[model samples]
Target: MDFAIGGMAAVCAGFFTNPLEVIKTRMQLQGELQKKNKQNIRYKNILHAGYQIVRHDGVLALQKGIVPALWVQLIMNGCRLGFYDYGLSRGYCNDKYGNVVFYKSVIVSGCGGVVGHYLSNPFYLIKTQLQSESAKAIAVGHQHHHKGTWKALSHIYFKEGVSTLAVIACAYVE
Candidate 1:
């Protein structure tokens, strides 16, 4: 199925993009927490942080969040493509000649992204939190942070409710 192709491509994209995503997360967290005003928030600044990481922690440090990121990306992209295909096949999209419009295809795709992100939010949050500078000291030996995915998920649910869906929704929009 074309959906499988899309899913595989997305997985590939996710793998390649994840390192930069980790760097971006770390940079943003660092910038937010530091007292000094950041002169630049450019990609170059992220690269500089990456360089610093390599200097201090070795190249392996650049891949600190790889495990959780891989989990999230694979699940997210797989479900996204699956849901899109489901929606399209269900006639959520229509053919031309007064049947269905292809623009509906875009809508289905967007919906797929939303659903996939929602399903994958806990993994994403954990990956981001794990990768963040602020989380490092606090999460060290912390039971909650070290807990399994389901446990972390239950914790998030207890803390945020369905309103947590808003965060995923916002991410989808962005």
Candidate 2:
């Protein structure tokens, strides 16, 4: 179905981009909230960051959050493409004359994306948390010691409660 195709495509894309994502996350967290001069620049730039991560944590480190990242992409894209297709089939993205309406299509696609994003927020949160983890010497941001994706999800649900997840997702939206 459209959902499966979309999800598979997203998973493929996520696999290729995950390393870059890992680098980006570490770079962003390296001197987070710190003033320019006061910040310790562990990751000089993208290449350096990638090098440092691999050197410290091994090649696999570049895929630190692959599991959750793939899950996020899969679920989000699946729902998004599926919903968009559904809307198209229902004529929600077409004018009365049966012509495709640009604005209507945009609205339907946006709605699908929003729904997908909302549904995948938890996986995204886990991905971010997991990706931020690194060897202490090269670690950046708040290092959450999540054993894995499922464990992280359970920890959040049991210890922090569902409301915590909602709040985090809402904060990202704003």
Candidate 3:
């Protein structure tokens, strides 16, 4: 039960972290030269940056990445907990008294992280592309290419297919 709760917590944590991640990625993708000239860029914190996004784009802007973010989180946490349970039940988490203490399962849990990410890479790649500034900019007036997740995925598959996935996997291997 504790592991189940922990998995749910992980899901929620992933959900909340995504908005800030969206902001951070956008900041990092901006021109370095332009960023270097901005005085406030160095000193501004997450709150300040979030405030700027809200100020310019309103409250709904914070939730731009929430859909894919939630999906990724749910899949990740579900696999993590499921695998942890499997490991524990399979004698991989035996304790001093042959009892499975929760901490003894950390190794299995960490492996679960890697497995979950790899299994879910396509989802995450789409998530990243959806949140990308270039895509967003192109989407401003181009409604045809700006379909929601499922449709956008079909577009990606039609245009790039598994090569897109292979590139992402290669990057991870590197």
Candidate 4:
């Protein structure tokens, strides 16, 4: 029940925020690895990003990685929230009434988030790549074009390396 509810909530939230995620990823991956040429940025700000994406790539551009994003969010948030609820129920981290203790909950939630994020790291990577990889966006000098989520993971693993995945997973938090 908890997993189901958590999954549903994650799906909703993922869909709602996917465009922001896409914009954020594009922002991060914009400006080449060299000294960032701020003058050459395609998407200036969040609003401008939204407008340009819709205008250039259509409305669906904002939802580029909708599949992988939703999957990652569903799995990550479900596991993290599930673990949190389990900890609270077991009185392991939260107060007796399941109210969160600030530090304890942070620790617990962070641990859960790390594990959950790790589990979904491949898809997360795919999501970032999907959002960032236009004809112009070259990630870390890699030029291989990816087809989809699994392909992106495979490209990162077989072509790139798993260390990349580690960085992505560890960077995320609750």
Candidate 5:
């Protein structure tokens, strides 16, 4: 119940925010770690980046990572909200007087968020990689030729091992 509602709400938010996310990813990846050169600039700004993606890859391009994005949001928010609600119900966030303790609530919610983030990190990695892919002319970042989220996950697991997944998640934090 709580999980479902939180997941659904996050999905809706993710759906609307994904395009901006796509734009942001591309912009960040463009000319990454390279010397600044005017010629290398493909996306001038958010609007231009969005326009270029639409012109070259169609409007749907803006939602390239929607599947993984939705999954990330659903899993992360579901666990987070569910855990928080469970804590509240169990009085884990309440003081001896039955008043909600601010520090206890923060700790409970933060733990939930951490758990959710850890579980969903793989999807987030896939989402960023997928969103980074674009037409060759407009492509930015190291393009990972992932067929889909599942394939990417499998490839990483099989080729890189389980530790790599954890490493990736940790690296994302830094």
Candidate 6:
């Protein structure tokens, strides 16, 4: 029940923030001087990213990858919050009188969040790629070329191999 409620709340908020996520990804991808050492900034900041995304790609573009993002959020938050709750119930994360032990709670919550992140990494990867593909530097960009999430995952696993599972390792520090 706690997990479901938390997931529901997260889903509701996610609908509103998903567009910002798209804008953020695009913005992060922009202004990179990685190879040539020459900055080519397309968005000045959040406002500009929002404006440019709608102006150039239409308002619908803001919702790109939202489905996967929601799945990522739902599963991630559900698992994170749910497992935290589970730890409390199991007596591993709370004091004898039921007060949460700060360090234990943090460790439990972090473990749960990492579990969620690991499970959602593939979807998050797809979300990131779909959201950032529209960046101006397509020529050198490594954005997934697949048209759908399934294809993207399939391609990543087949071509990228164990590197795909390495996503879980990245989640450990989160």
Which one wins on lDDT? 5
Assess the local accuracy of residue 87 in candidate 2 as a C-alpha lDDT between 0 and 100: 88
Task: Give the Å shift of residue 146 in candidate 2.
Answer: 0.4
Error of 2 at 16 (Å): 0.7
Candidate lDDT (C-alpha), each: 0.64, 0.88, 0.62, 0.74, 0.90, 0.77
Query: Once superposed on the true structure, which residue ranges of model 4 sit more than 4 Å away at CA?
Result: 31-35, 94-106, 135-144, 160-174
Candidate rank order under TM-score: 2, 5, 6, 4, 3, 1
Clashing pairs in 4: none
Over 118-167, each residue of candidate 1 has an lDDT whose tens digit, in order, gives 76666777777656532333221222344545665677778888678567
Question: What lDDT does candidate 3 reach at residue 24?
Answer: 68
Which tens-of-lDDT digit does each residue in 124-173 have in candidate 6?
A: 87888888766343322455666877778787778878675576447633
Q: Give the Å error, residue 35, model 5.
A: 4.8
Alpha-carbon runs more than 4 Å astray in model 2: 36-39
Evaluated at residue 11, the lDDT of candidate 1 is 66
Which stretches of model 1 miss by more than 4 angstroms?
1-4, 35-44, 96-100, 133-174
Q: Write the per-residue lDDT of candidate 2 for residues 19-138, one digit (tens) a residue.
A: 999999888776673555545778988999999999999999999999999999998999889888888999999999999899988898888788788878888999999998999888
**What is the total number of backbone clashes in candidate 6?**
0
Query: What TM-score does structure 3 among the candidates reach?
Result: 0.68
Better of 2 and 4 by TM-score: 2
Per-model TM-score versus the true fold? 0.67, 0.94, 0.68, 0.74, 0.93, 0.82
Error of 2 at 173 (Å): 2.8
Candidate ordering by lDDT (highest first)? 5, 2, 6, 4, 1, 3
Every model's Cα RMSD, please?
5.2, 1.5, 5.1, 3.9, 1.8, 2.9
Give per-residue CA lDDT, model 3, range 1-174, as digits (tens): 534665578768977777777666555544343456632242155676567666665666666656666666766676778778878878888875778767768888777766666656666666666554333322221123334667766777788897876676556534
Model 2 residue 10 distance off true place after TM-score fit, in angstroms: 0.8
The lowest-lDDT stretch of 10 consecutive residues in candidate 1 is 134-143
